[model samples]
Target: MARIAQESPGAPHILIVGGGYVGMYTALRLQKKLRRELRRGEVRVTIVDPNSYMTYQPFLPEAAAGNISPRHVVVPLRRVLPKCTVRKARVTELNHDEGWAIVQPLAGPPERISYDYLVMAAGAVPRLLPIPGLAEHGISLKTVGEAIHLRNHVLEQLEIAESTDDAELRRKALTFVFVGGGFAGVEAVAELEDMTRDATKYMRKVTPQDLRFILVEAAGRILPEVGPDMGKWTAEQLRGRGIDVKMNTLLESAVDGRIELSDGSSFQAGTLVWNAGVKAAPVVRRGGLPVDEKGRVKGTEYLTIEGLVRAFTAGDNAAIPDLTQEGMYCPPNAQHAVRQAKLLGDNIVRSLRGKTLKPYVHSNVGAVAGLGLHKGVAQTYGFKVKGWPAWFMHRTYHGAKVPTFNRKLRVVADWTLALFLKRETVSLATIEQPRADFQLAALDDVRPKERAADQAREPAA
Candidate 1:
């Protein structure tokens, strides 16, 4: 068992699990608000997550489309929460009743960590269904790494299609399919299609007409985050750009590169991007905490786990009661995550000082999504905007909310540079398998040596 480093032996220790919006923002707030307590060893905050950085998911589509630099879309936890103890690990189990958790570090065996307070901000994971070949063929877009890989993959497919002499191979390579039509799926397909169209201009064999982009959704309409009218308009705009918007359709199967849709449609696509949905992290279920049917930790209006003491949760992992609406919980989105984090930090500080905890309450601000360059949809405070204005709103809102002036400046600079310069379409697919070349070279050298040794061992003819 490791104590995870506390300055005072008896002082209260806060063990925060996860480094996403909730964990990062909560720790950031604690570090600032409890500066004196942290310095005096009165309270200790320790954060554990597998990654060292927190990725901003809204810009993933843009990053994938080369509109924003992949490096700028993530915030480093160590740099942001200097006052808290950040552990590069994942909590495998928890004993909330005893205030201890089992953490498995990136390279070390599992260790028990005792805490006075536990924050279950472990975030969410891709909600995969039991579909044939889905696991093997489908690519996801939840992390910055995945976003980068998708970008390289999209460009690589174009290269393959352009270079291939076989029409079947070319057709398959040029066809891109995206499952799910929510914000992530719609934006990803739209942005990538836009980028691909621009990329085709630079290719001699590949034209914009030669490429195909298809969006599959199980719902009746796309962009349910916005108003139905706006969603319809967005769908229409997408179709106008030559995209195949197949609503009320599901990806029944994706065996190898063959796609089978629920609507009796079939096709061969080289790229299959899956953005179906996400559920709370599995750790929340394993922790023995009170979780809802969907595996999210049941949170009180105060943002603490129900029927538990000194244990808190919010964000996608918590089904926190929405004070603004009857019988409704806060939606799993960045807006609530950021807002709840502030209150969660304050409540924790109040609890330490024997003050009454305040409940978290916030109204829906609205929703905004970008559909490629100069195209978007937004519904803020009841006002709906589309096209260029909505796109501008999407950038402005996310740009301001992306945390830290450094990242904001970098994102804005990327947008600024895009206005004057042509989008860079170079594909660095080799980065995914960086050691492949080195391994092949080593194998070649060993092959000759092995051949010589075999010849030397054989009897003379």
Candidate 2:
């Protein structure tokens, strides 16, 4: 099949198994460092991923709320890594002994890919619990499609509320519950709330007071990484905005349209976004490498697979210990991922040149989290900052870390334009059911109603 490309002759072929922060950055660094070697056919690099683009997940909430254009958040693989071959495929399995990996490409049969050097950067996926009906109704904002879907869904609910007299359904649709209170959950809910509140000016039926925004966290604190005082202030700020901050509350079950919580609250809500945690990609498990207690591959300070020195692993899928923090593994955050990738790239080249590899050890600078417009909480260098300063810090730090200059410029431009323009609240939630209207029209001759009683109490547009 066209999916199977033969390795270049007489060159050391490098295979990158994922196109996430670790995969893209590692390959990007390698191509830059080994450009002359690659041109002379001394080294060949192939980057295989399911998608041709790398998503900047930190900007996803802004994208979902239309604070930033979605296009600006993803860097196309072909554009940045021109010297490296980017293949659109999922690494289904790996064979370290055979020195080849199995790739399942879209629209073709699976094939085996050979390589002299292997980089396992297959990141993590959203962890799902066995909660009932979640698989069917719960929406995720992990990818570009997911973010766009969320944006459209939120706006559609507003439209539905404006057009319908069915108060119960409207209420259900407008009520949004976020399962986790960590970064993704908090950022997503806050940005969405900010956008929806702004959009309420256009709707008579749906007021800012009508929307129910719930932030559910099982732990005692919402932003534990941030200090106690700042975290409490964040909760208070959320409360000031009329968000239901439910800490130490557990979601017992969610099936059909009903939800039951461990706090003994039961209700019906149409929109649910789960951002609780994540699990390592399945590709890492099938790769036949050394993984730790968790499903991540165990890597040395050099990010070399536990015992296999040539193969490297990083990002969320690698269980590299935080040697500084006793009995603790590195928390799978982007801060660590990018740093590990940088080291992984440097170590790979050093190993080839018969140079000593450096150990992976970093003293965490602290954490920063954005909680909607001009509201954030952060902890850095043993100091806490909240409100505007924290929010600014959040943007500044992420702007600096968001990969290539092209992407950085695009993101900065998005933020710059956002300063002057209002957020876009037009959600195309109906896209989820593009054919539902057609089916209804064919079967029952039914179309969506969007009318309200006027002066004469007659149906008016």
TM-score of every prediction relative to native: 0.97, 0.92
**What local distance difference test score does each model get?**
0.93, 0.85
The per-candidate count of clashes, in order, stands at 0, 3
Summing lDDT over every window of 10 consecutive residues in candidate 2, give the lowest-scoring window.
445-454
Query: How many clashing pairs does model 2 include?
Result: 3
Candidate 2, 432: how far from true, in Å?
4.5
For model 2, the stretches where C-alpha displacement exceeds 4 angstroms are 1-4, 430-461
Give the Cα RMSD of candidate 2: 6.7
Among all windows of 10 consecutive residues in model 1, the one with the lowest summed lDDT is 1-10
Residue 60 lDDT in candidate 1: 98
Give the residue spans of candidate 1 off by over 4 A. Answer: 1-7, 457-461
Error of 2 at 456 (Å): 46
For candidate 1, the lDDT comes to 0.93
Give per-residue lDDT, candidate 1, residue 282: 89
